[model samples]
Target: MRLTSGVFMFLLLVLSSVCVAETYNMETQFIAPIKLPINLVPLVNEHLDSPFERYGCAASLRQSLEASFVRLSPTAEPSILVKPAESCLCGVHTCSFWILRQCGATYCFAGHLHAHSIEINQATLLNDYYGLTGLPGGATSSEATHFLFDGKSYVEEKIEPKQIK
Candidate 1:
């Protein structure tokens, strides 16, 4: 009887852990761009070109950047979503956003977009990555652009028109 109870306890513990793991949801939470990881700095420098030269932002790249961590899948590594913070990195409506995913020891660009806001849809996925909706002018915007991973990168799938009240 003691052995049976022990086995039942072990099963209960394992089932509870599995349920917790399956219910984990990844949400985007934006935060101030802190000092980037040493491995990520070079990728940022390469992909995130000089905003000063392009948009004439007074602040340096690191200063104008905001960041968020998101895991595309329950089993996948978390990816960093870097976005513009200052006015210089944005247009009248939208700002640039980039996603970087770790590959082996280093990170690589997964996607890029210019949008007022972004939402990751876990229900939809392609190439083992979550689908992204880029709202160019906020939730009330007339249209939202959908992007899906194309094995190599995220590409625009369609422009969905939204009904405005």
Candidate 2:
């Protein structure tokens, strides 16, 4: 129930394109263009849910969560990542997570990207340096992020806060 590497890798390209409008003082037109994996596009065009549909994909809910789990998860071995969407709208899907094995320990990550059926509102999306946004009911309106534990030490990082140009 997870997106394949090609699928997520394509999303990464999109993520890479979306440079925060604030830091760069760029226009919205420059936001990362959505180029989901071509092979998976058909399923999405048909409005079908990918394997990432089940869990909330909630940043916290996913296994050893990681944004790139859908693509680069297996390489890590004993790691995990959680998907997004604790309460998805389509009942089809919203987000995903991944975990991989690290040196003698497990590293978990929570990712929310490459959503297939989830409707997106680019204008409302937090166009910050980190390309993250918060939501209501505990979801941040700027960036969806939180502290994660490596099962040994806690990694301190969050989506960069959005700032005005």
The most accurate candidate by lDDT is 1
C-alpha TM-scores of all predictions? 0.67, 0.21
Clashing pairs in 1: none
Poorest stretch of ten by lDDT in candidate 2: 21-30
Compared with the true structure, model 1 gives a TM-score of 0.67
Worst 10 residues of 1 by lDDT: 20-29
Per-model lDDT: 0.66, 0.30
Q: Candidate 1 on 19-67: residue-level lDDT in tens?
A: 4411111122354344446556456666654545244554455655556
Q: How does residue 135 of candidate 1 score in lDDT?
A: 68
Q: Model 2: what TM-score?
A: 0.21
